[model samples]
Target: MRYDWTPLWRSTIGFDRLFDVLDEVQRTADETYPPYNIERVDENRFQISVALAGFSSYEVALTVEQNVLTLEGRKGEKDEKTFLHRGISTRSFKRQFTLADHVEVKGARFENGLLLIELQREIPEAMKPRRIAITGAGPGKVSQIEAKAA
Candidate 1:
């Protein structure tokens, strides 16, 4: 199915990136392999965990480029054996995630058949909000000073 974002494009300003992301998401297929979870650890921290039961850490790869995080997994060759009832799947899969501005991947670890990726939003000190001190005079005093200058 396709989506029409023409109306949104006309009404919003400086949101081209947002529209682009939405378009990209719509064009991609809905993949369910290697389930994952996104959790908010704190106000600016997040964690993503993926279930990789049969795959080892060496079989999986993670890459971040131009704000896009990609995960790829390739199962190793199995021994020659007959399976009467195979339940576990060792299929390879690829996943992609788009990161927002100022968000960075801190690290990733594989433990107990799960791959955990950590992310943190680190806004520069200059971009963070800060309070400005109000000093000198009230509106009346400022108006008197302006009048004297006039």
Candidate 2:
């Protein structure tokens, strides 16, 4: 399936980045390598686990840029050895995940041949919702402020 974003691009302003992200996702939608899982631990916490049976911590790299998390894995030099049947896939691969605003990577760890990434949404203090105060006067009274010309 395909989509036409020309109309959206012409109708919206300041959404170029969003359209670009959508295009990128569409381009990589068919790439399924190094199986992974995305789990929501809680309302503000998320975890991404990638299965890398023959990969080690030293062979993988994680980076985040422009709200996008990229995972790359590259195995070390191969040793000269004969294998009766090669099964484990230690191939190099790259995967990317787009995170929402305020979502930041907390940490990552490799255990039991699986790479786990931790993420948390930390909204800035100024961006959080605030309560507004309302003042009212009685039916017969009206509140007014006296101002002096400066």
Candidate 3:
């Protein structure tokens, strides 16, 4: 079945660039060569784990540029391998996870052939949603509540 996303653009303003970026990410994320998992740990915490079975710490490189997390793995030729019939493939793989603004990468670790990435939401004060307090017409004009707390 074919799907059209043009209708979504009608009500949106100043979000054309964001939709373009999403399109690119969807196009590039189709190749599931290396499997991954994304899970929410808590209210403001998240984790992303990627399976790097045959890759060692030295063979993989991780980087967080701006809000994009990139994982690059390239396997070098093994000098001591003496395999008669090699079945396990040691191919290069690269994966990218685009992060939202104020979503910070806390830490990353390798354990049990899985690379775990820890993330925490750091919502900025100005970007957070705020609610305006209402009052009686003669008693109080208005009040402002902390937007970040919400």
For residues 1-150, write the lDDT of model 1, one tens digit per residue: 888999888889999899988888787757888889999999999999999998888899999999999999998887598989887778989999899889999999988889999999999999999999988777667434345545
What is candidate 2's lDDT per residue for 1-150, written digit by digit as tens? 667688998889999879888888788889999889999999999999999998888899999999999999999999598999999988999999988899999999988888999999999999999999887785899777999999
In candidate 3, what are the lDDT values of residues 22-127, reduced to their tens digit? 7766677567868889999998899999888888889989999998999999998765968899756678988888887788989989999899999999888898
Candidates arranged by TM-score, highest first: 1, 2, 3
* TM-score of each model, in listed order: 0.82, 0.77, 0.74
User: Which candidate leads in lDDT?
Assistant: 2
Error of 1 at 103 (Å): 1.5
Candidate 2 — worst ten consecutive residues by lDDT sum?
1-10
Q: Model 2: residues >4 Å from true position, as ranges?
A: 6-22, 135-150
Q: Which segments of candidate 3 are over 4 A away from where they belong?
A: 1-4, 13-22, 79-87, 135-150
Per-residue error for 136 in candidate 2, Å, reads 5.2
Error of 3 at 133 (Å): 3.1
For all candidates in order, the CA lDDT equals 0.90, 0.91, 0.84
Instruction: Count backbone clashes in candidate 1.
Output: 0
